[model samples]
Target chain A: MSQGRERVYINDVAPRDGLQIEKQWVATADKVRLIDGLMATGLARVEATSFVSPRAIPNLADAAEVVQGIRRVSGVGIVVLVPNVKGCERALASGVDEINLVMSASESHSRANLRMSPEQSLAQFAEIVDLAKGSGVFVNGSLSTAFGCPFDGEVPQSRVLGFIERLLELGVEGVTLADTTGMANPAQVARLCEAVMTRWSQVPFTLHVHNTRGMGLANCLAAWQSGVTQFDAALGGLGGCPFAPGATGNVCTEDLVHMFEQMGVDTGVDLAALIELSTTLPELVGHDVPGQVAKAGPADRRYPCPAGL
Target chain B: MSQGRERVYINDVAPRDGLQIEKQWVATADKVRLIDGLMATGLARVEATSFVSPRAIPNLADAAEVVQGIRRVSGVGIVVLVPNVKGCERALASGVDEINLVMSASESHSRANLRMSPEQSLAQFAEIVDLAKGSGVFVNGSLSTAFGCPFDGEVPQSRVLGFIERLLELGVEGVTLADTTGMANPAQVARLCEAVMTRWSQVPFTLHVHNTRGMGLANCLAAWQSGVTQFDAALGGLGGCPFAPGATGNVCTEDLVHMFEQMGVDTGVDLAALIELSTTLPELVGHDVPGQVAKAGPADRRYPCPAGL
Candidate 1:
């Protein structure tokens, strides 16, 4: 069996991707506090907020304030999602450590979700990369629907590989293959992740999965077995696919860390602290979140014998 | 990497282990219909009910009625949990294809749940096995808390292995290692499953895991990677750890089947039919279940382009 890397890296995206679709608007101060709490849990990175148009995503309207209000810790990268050159400029002005540019691997999903074709999104990424050229901010490209698009069924490996090459060629320092609609299976994840890791031996690739079909952690395991080390997760499993409405979103950060840590893989995350933070999410979001570890406790948690026994 | 097996076997325990703890009583007719619905989905087996005392599990008080009412199809084993010689006799008299004898691997859990020690449970199993000798009923042993115990913490592998030997010697046709309280990790699962499979190559072993810590599917993947082919799942994720009150129950049946089927492994199950059956769980049990696929649809489900796009 392929025993993956000894250490893994986690980037919590609850503030940006997670809260983007919520009906209730999260206060800017609370967003900052959530990001700060995430950062203190020894996460490799935290996608704090997004720099998209406020009208498009009202929940993250105070992105700039959220970025500015959070404490910056050394060695922890603060990332913000940037949809285009305009968002990139705003994210740069906010002094973010990294700006993640978004696009979709499938044409239909790209047009429907981003209001642009894949080719058009690629052209925009080039412009965004150009703007961040010497600003000391890392540029990362995220390809949505990299596994399978909800509108277009299967996304050919050739198409995903071609897009990854173009993103890297445009000076994007890293790439994240996102299962935007949670269509990824473990076998597909292993095959694609292995192909990408082998072809791009030097690139830092992150696996971003959703638990829409309950395969989030399973796909993560398959990717790790295929040599992936970085992952994008959301606190309390808070994110959802806007296209697929009720489907659950990103893999829960605490659950992922718990799996890796239990496997003896070093995630460099404080799971207890992360679980503690996850507890406050239900009240913060005005509803129950999908996270399990917070409710179930850790694997080693011991319970007292039942009263009569 | 270990590709494990091309074909997997799934046994649904929804009617028994699942309803055992529900405060809402599912009617006997509904239980029969549920089992019939599950059996029609081409499951390898359906653990229809448990022959334990009705007072102990009032929801399953109609176990005999359920087993007798369901349509028994050829090639699909009908199994029932039997706690003692009395339960075993009741199961055999009801004409069940298999009698699942359960005992916890850990001391505290065995005493707390079964009101007996491991030795006492084993002694009772020998008597039950003797009773079922000529009845043509397949005898299966399930070791609960095989991975870990809620009160005693980790259950040593030596003790589990020793118990498996005793069960096999007592003429148990199969063995299932159960992570009863959802306290198992993937690494531990892979290790223990590999050990048991290696030591008992000819014995049919099933893996029963809980989603309490959100490692349900991941642990299943690990066990499959370690060469386990048979699994125990609950429909709609209906079961919960009675000892750990708020924790989620057995890995959802449809979700497990979906993951394996998506991975290109044939589980001899109809995913659509299983998912359709999962949808009726809310009305039957008077609560929304924890299953994701029933709510999110399958990974291959397609969505239409937004109105403007």
Candidate 2:
């Protein structure tokens, strides 16, 4: 419990991870409103949108408009998801503060999802990393299926280490270990984070997990214990893997914040505001969302004494 | 991580704690069916019913019949919730293997919920404890609101230790520290369990947490790290404090079991069978249940490769 007082960093991935698979097309104005709502709650970093081809993810086809429509705050950094050099070029012109590059740890997943071998994806990333170096934009490399690959199953830790080494050498400022389909357990999370943190002590490491198996936050806690604090969560748990049929969504950002704040960990989040915004998600998506704090409220929240009692 | 491989004991409190507040009167036979289903999943302990007045908890009014009707499996124990000497007398006659006595650490919660002051409740517990010493039944004293009280708020660790001393002195074989309204945080849970285990090393400590703030499993993980292993959870996250207005439900037993099993901690539970039973709960209660794993599947469950991919 010594880490109870430590401040944990959070990066909301709702606009990118959460909304990627939404069938209902949200208006660009609505996406901008949601992003502004999240920024108003004191989140330092918000993954606002992704610059993928409209044919790849039509729901986020308005990514450029979203970045253009959302008000920019002084301290909040906006993140844009980019897959290749072309996406990076679009993101650089889109005025985002950071760009996140995606790759896969397993060749099967890389071929199925990204249509490239791991090495091919890394080679493409090298160009994107080099292209963005002098543009004043931070590049974050994310390794998908780092915990377990649905297509191949049981990704080797050595593959993750190799990817990390190459990503760092590519001049990426940070790396995200993405549990693309929520396949990680706490023990596995601890072992991987320990191995990575021991060797590359200076590189910023973040966890991108899903609640597919309901171990998302448990894995986050294990990562924190292993000395990795930065995390990526989605508001209302909006996103899931389209290829992975049963994958739920990324860990709910508000629920994660509620847990951290309750445990006396400083998250620099306004829980009341977050919960309030979480309630509006059901109407936004035309369905009820998966967040918990919106339904349960904070721990100290009190109800009025019953009439008779 | 050191405790990742340890086996944790689970007491499925669905019949007693779960159905106690259910609006639909789950037929007495349905209760028996549910209990039988749980027992077949290799769970060692099942809290069968409560022996309180039928008018007090009408849902469990068939407690005696449920105890008599459920199929008994070898190596499994049935526990009943008892509030006073009369409940204890009835539970003893019903032939439950264990009886859990309830009191609250906060005087306000005790009076509001049980209509007795803390001291008066303990005095009555003394008689109930004396009556069943040689009756071949294990006595468990549960301090409700020991973690935090909705009425009084922030129950002190000193008060909990004082109550633990009294319960142990009264010959209770075990004590369960209950987060009655889900107010306990992870750090608070770790600190309190550490203090209690330090003073009463021989007493069996179990955790009974609610998901009021969605910290149920997190608190259990904290308590587990502090050397407490036994826990009480409800299937499908059923049951909350009927008196605490905003309290949600207990930790989802299958979700907790899934998390533990994924981390290589054994609960001897057949997860596939438990999951199968969880899918039937929505029809049993006529509404959606709160459990996560049922909808999300297990961590290792893989979907078939899509045709094009």
Error of 2 at B59 (Å): 0.8
CA displacement after TM-score superposition, residue A202 of candidate 2 (Å): 0.3
Question: Lowest lDDT 10-mer window, candidate 2 chain A?
Answer: A300-309
| Model 2 agreement with the true structure over B32-140: per-residue lDDT tens digits | 9999999999887999999989999889889899999989998788999998899999999988899999999987778778887889989999999999989999999
Q: What value does the interface RMSD of model 1 take?
A: 1.7
- lDDT value, residue B61 of candidate 1: 83
Off by over 4 Å in 1: A1-4, B1-4
Question: Considering only N, C-alpha and C atoms within 3 Å, which residue pairs clash in candidate 2?
Answer: A18-A239
Scored by DockQ, the top model is 1
Best by lDDT: 1
Residues A89-153, candidate 1, lDDT per residue (tens digit)? Answer: 89999999999999999988898889899999999888998899999999899999999998889
| lDDT tens digits by residue: candidate 1, B203-283 | 999999999888899889999999999999999998998666566889999999999888889999999999999999999
Estimated TM-score per prediction?
0.98, 0.96
Note the residue pairs that clash in candidate 1: A239-A249
Candidate 1, overall lDDT? Answer: 0.91
Model 1: TM-score, first chain: 0.98
